[model samples]
Target: MNHQTRLQALSAFLKAQRAKILPDSVGFTSGNRRRTPGLRREEVAQLAGVSPTWYTWLEQGRDIRVSTSVLDCIATALQLTIDERKYLYALAQESGSGATLLKEQLPEISPSLKRILHELRFCPTIITDRRYYIVGWNEAASHVFLDFEQIPSEQRNMIRLLFTRKELQRLAVNWEHFTKGFLAIFRAYYGQYVEDEWYERFLDEMKAVHPDFNILWQQSDVQSAPEVLIEFRHSKAGKMLFHLTSLQVQGSTDLRCSIYTPVPDSSTEYKLKQLIERK
Candidate 1:
């Protein structure tokens, strides 16, 4: 969508959200003979701590600059959910930075990176780009999760697999937590390519394939990649815990390598070893 169209949509969205919230919802006494269904623009502005005129201008879709903080306040005042907040930002496109589309062809993985994946005997490692496309992975990763090679190239997205693949649901002990974190990280990256055709296509496909994905994607939660503890239910190894770490691939701005290592003092290490031996 173009800038004007986006702003218009955002204006409409805010107005709709505001109309959904009744006066009593924000602790106001409901006086008799209310004409409007929800809180007024002035009331929203008061609750959001912004000027009524400014709020009105925003709702009018005027070309006024808005800060992230003000938008956040509005989101809070409106009691927007995580997904709603995200959708708001997606419409606003606050940063003014342009989105760079991915190349038509996938970038080739460096030979050294491939070797590193191969050499990481104990760690389950996978390489992905900013869009979460699985470009490379080690045998350990294939064993820990499903074999990426077996998945069709177009369908080898981590986020897509998490939601659509039944095996992933069975493997992840805390599926909701994992998916939320993944979505947050994905959102963090999404801002950089919000206008890219490929990104838009992927989002459309995801929404079409998984209804829940659309709900989560709207939450507008953005988080940097972080080290996290995750639990997996391995058919052969039983329950296993890993310290999942994401690191940027050196010399590559967009590529990232993720490694899952057994947590210290856990039987996960032994279990992984056993699983490897069975292979």
Candidate 2:
């Protein structure tokens, strides 16, 4: 979407949201016979702690600048969902040119890279681009997680799977912790391409498919990929632990390889071996 189109859409979305909220919903009494069903523009501005004229101009789709803090206030006043808030930010801030650039520089994995993944016999390994798209994985990875080959190419994002895939969620021993950590890592990477159309679309799809994702996203936490001790409750192995490590591919700046090694002095190694054999 272009800048003008985004502004128009943003205007329409804000108006629609404002129309859905009743005066009583924001701590005001419905004292008089209402001319409209929802709060008026001035009333919304007051609730959001912004100047009435400023808010009016925003609703009017004037070429006005909006800060993230102000947007956060407006989101809270309007009770916008995480997805809605993200959409609002995209419409307000994204230039759309970054999407074109990103597309031109899309990451690729070679056959040798796939072979390397397969060669990691004891460790469950997977390769992803900066956007967390699952480009490749090993047999051990398939044994630990779902087989990426079985999933549609477009739906192979790690963050997407974390939210939408029930099996993965079930396997997580601490789902909330794992998801929060994952989201933080994603958020950190997203900072580099906040205005990209692909990122916007991905965020939109995630919010649409998983409402819970929005909640975590709103936290605005930033974190790099960390080597952490993670546990999973495998259906066959019962329980297993691994030390997760994320390393960037040497030549491909955008590509990252994540490996999960069994913790020392645990039955995780034996369990992983058995799991791989069963597969």
Candidate 3:
């Protein structure tokens, strides 16, 4: 897109985002005389610590040099999602970095990675793309988690399943805690792929169906891949606990391989064996 088009897009995005935030949500009273849906440009300027005229010029798509710090302040004022924040940066043409791979350019799983997952017979292992779509899995993963083969290609996302899949939710002993942490990592990835529209669509669809997702997303929590202990109560296997660890796939920046290892002193290993045997 050309410079003018980018500016117009940024203007529209800022307006749309500004419309989503209620004045009362950001410590302003909803006076009866309001004609707009959300906080006014002046209110946003106050929150962002920018001049009202300058902010108005930005919303008007005027040619202005937006510094990174100013963009971040505007993002904070608008309460944009990670995806929305990154898209704002892209639209403003502020990202000075070189070209990076989009999600569409994600490479296929190498044979070595496939073999590694296969050999991890006892561990429930799955490889996911930047968007948390389950792209690779082993037999253990199929048994421990729901069978990825049975899930439709579009519904193979980990966050989608976490919220929409009733069985998985019921199985997770600490569903809220686990989901929150997982969502934080997803937030990190969501911010990187500014060119991908799929992230925005997926986020909207998820928030539409799950109110909790909307609430959690608004928290704006972000974390690097952290080791987590997850406990599950399978219908057949009963109580099981596993430590989840993530590793970046070699030669691929957009792929992550996560392995679920049985926690020490837990019956998880024995239970996984039984679960796999019945599979």
lDDT of every predicted structure (CA atoms)? 0.79, 0.78, 0.79
Q: What is the TM-score of each candidate against the true structure?
A: 0.73, 0.63, 0.66
Model 3: per-residue Cα lDDT over 1-279, one tens digit each: 345655665787688788889898899999999998999999999999999999999999999888889989999999976656776776675352333445455457888888999899989998988778888999988887788999876668899898888888888887888788778777656544445556667787988999999887665455547688888888788888999998877663568889999998988898888878875
**Quality of model 2 by C-alpha lDDT:** 0.78
**Clash list (residue pairs), candidate 3:** none
Q: Which ten residues in a row have the lowest lDDT in candidate 2?
A: 95-104
Write candidate 2's Cα lDDT for 1-279 as tens digits: 445656665677678778888888788877787787788889889999999999999988888989999999998888877656665676676622343335344467888887888778889998887788887888988888998899987778899899878889999899888888777667545544445556667778888888888887764344556778999999888899999998878783567888999999999999999988875
Model 3, runs deviating above 4 Å: 1-107
Count clashing residue pairs in model 2: 0
The residue ranges of model 1 lying beyond 4 angstroms of the native Cα positions read 1-49, 56-63, 67-99, 102-104, 250-253
Where does model 2 exceed 4 Å of error?
1-106
lDDT of 1 by residue, 1-279 (tens): 456655665786788788889798788877987677788899999999999999999988888888889989999999887756776676665542344635455567988888999899889998887788888999888889998898987778899899878888889898887788788777656554545546556777888988888877665345656689999998778999999898878674478889999899999888888888887
- In candidate 2 the C-alpha lDDT for residue 48 amounts to 93
